[model samples]
Target: MAARLLIGVLAVSGLGLALSLVAGTVLLRDYLYGRVAEQVSGLSQAPDVRPGAIAPSRLCEVTDAPAVLPSDFRLTVIEADGSVRCRVPGDQTGPPVPSVDELRDWADDDAAAVVRDDSGSWATSVDAFDQPGRDGGKGYVMVAISLRNADLTVQRVAVGGAAIGVVVLAVLALAGRMVIRIGLRPLTDVREAAREIRHGDLSARVPPGKPGTEVADLSTALNSMLEEIQRGFEKRRESEQRIRQFATDASHELRTPLTSIKGYAQLYAQMAARNTGSDAGTSIAREARKDVEQRRAEVVSRIDSEADRMSGIVEDLLLLARLDQQPELVKERVDLVEIAHDVLTAARAGHPERRLDLKVEGPVEVEGDPGRLQQVVANLVTNAIVHTPSAIVVAAATTDGVAVLEVRDDGPGMPAEVQHRIFDRFYRADVGRSRRSGGSGLGLSIVRALVEAHGGSLECVSSVARGSTFTVTLPRAS
Candidate 1:
């Protein structure tokens, strides 16, 4: 690119220099030729020549001739009889005499002509005069000044101008090359950055250019695009990783329940087979059957409980999938305080020994799906009650044009790191304890998704041993 730009610059500059040199040379040559013509015309009007009276040997002598004539100046006389005589200043041989036909062609005294001969080129003019004693016979006086000096001067100027033009072009090419390289440096940086990005280096960036220049604007635009692309790649990678982890966790969770169900079924089958093959008295067989029935009942109850747990996990997973797809929600005005009250009431009934409290500052009306909002309140309250041994407080209020619901517990709170990923599906802070307590770990995840779907946000503030507070903020009903 730099080379192309440099070439373009040189081409334009060189063309301009060439045209200037040509024009200067042409103007100078014309001016020089005009000056020579003027000199020849002045010399032609000199009253020095009397061709008929001068002897052939003394035709070159002229008393009235300019004493300072140029050494290369020549004079020629042609009498009526077609006799020609030529004379040059300072003994320099001049151009050959003009032929009779050529002299006849220059019959006008005011006309000037350029004549070239073996000696050199000359600017020549002719003046006709009648001889004092001749009858209808005229003599011609011709004056010529050499054009060699003018031509040489023009030639020198042309050559010199061309040489200077070449030098200027060379200098311009060098300077233009440097300027083009510097100007295109930003583009070079951008190309390298793009190449690096293509090779999987997302952090590479183009160097900045001068403000308000086209290259700067381009750099800014390309940088923005690269940043967006990098962000997109990061998000995609993170999503894939989450999907893999989710699949693994889901499989593990289902396997646990399936393993228990399988074991209980096999035990039930063994108990039945043993009873059927027993060869005993009727009372003994009857007692054996009663015991087997009681054991089978316990086994079937456990199997049902595992199946219910598995069903809950599947249902939560499906709900998350739907939320991920951004399903349309049933939007309506719902009172968050009422939802908190109901969730607290259920908690109290479920855990009579544990103290649960509900605080309502106001109606806290918000626009959202009622079922989903209630579920959100229930999940947060349940999580507090299950994780903390202290009394749980579920509160709802309207603050700053938004409906806020907070579930607080004075228990062993979590660390900052745990709070950050608490809403991740199937992520448990206390994995063993959560599994033993039949916690599916999808409760908080579902809560977050539901809140976001309603154009709300969920946040958890926690610190070890102090307390944990889960706050959900939703837009107030308008």
Candidate 2:
């Protein structure tokens, strides 16, 4: 690109120089000829010639003429009858002279003509040479000044001008190349940085040269993009680590239930074997069998409870996985107030010991999947009931084109540190309590995911000894 720029500049400069040279050369040639014509005309108008007896006029010799006339100027006298005469050394041929008709026209009209021939070029000036005190009676005097030297001068000037133009163009090309290289240095740096980045170096960046230029803007943008990419890569690695840990935790959790079931089954089998192999009296054997049957029933009940707990955890995990994939939801207008009321009624019925307060202004509808939306409300109410022993407040209202649902609890509030990760999957504020209470720790995470999938936002506000509040905001249907 730089080379192309230099070539373009040179081409334009060369064209302008060519035009200037031609105009200047023509002006110089015209001025030189004008000066020659003036001299020839002046010399011809002189009145110092004497006529001969036989010759019509015996013009003064060019060398013997007045000093005002140029030395190389050749003089010619033309009579009224179209005869030509000139005084010159017998050994040298005089230069080409103007024709008789040209001479007569000049003498009659007092005009001049520049004539050229093989011998050389001349500026011819003719004037009537009348005797003193006579009325236009004598012949005409014509003077020819050689233009060979003037032609040679013009040619030399043209050659010098062409050489100067060539030198100027060469200098311009060199200067242009240097300027272009300096101007485009930033681009070279950018290219090298880009190459490094392409090879997996996200930290590479172009150094911003001077500010307030295109290069500076590009550098800033590229650096910003690199920063974003690096952050995304770090986030992805963090997510992968979290997933691996989650898988391990899930396996450990599933194994606990399975292990309990297996232990109970083994105990039941051992008891049955003992009952079958009794070799005592009938009454003692019957009594031992009855005791063994009761113990076996308790073992089976424990196994059934563990299986239910495992099934709940598996179902919650599957729900979370499906939410992660962003499944399409039903797009229907649902009333948040109605959902909140229903959820509150269920929570109150299930946990009658806990006080549930529901405050709903009116119908606040939003476009969403009714089932998912109801699930969101249920999860929040359930999470509050399980975590806190205080009263649960469920509120729904419409404010500023948004449908707001909030579930607040005054139970043993969480710490500020725990509040940050409360919405993370499988994150439990009190792990031991959560496990004993059959809390899968995915309630808040699923609530947040469901809220967001409805084009809304969910946030948790909680502090130790202070009640926790979960607020969900969804855009109201237009």
**Alpha-carbon TM-score of each model against the true structure:** 0.89, 0.64
For model 1, give the 10-residue run with minimal summed lDDT. Answer: 48-57
lDDT of each: 0.82, 0.80
Q: Quote model 1's TM-score.
A: 0.89
lDDT score of residue 168 within candidate 1: 89
Candidate 1 at residue 70, lDDT? Answer: 48
lDDT of 1 at 227: 91
Q: Indicate the worst ten consecutive residues by lDDT in candidate 2.
A: 47-56
Q: Residues 266-308, candidate 2, lDDT per residue (tens digit)?
A: 9999998998899667888888888999999999999999999
Estimate the overall C-alpha local distance difference test score of candidate 2. Answer: 0.80
Per-residue lDDT tens digits for candidate 1, residues 157-258, read 889988998898899888888888887788789889989988999999988778998988898999998899999999999999988978888988899899
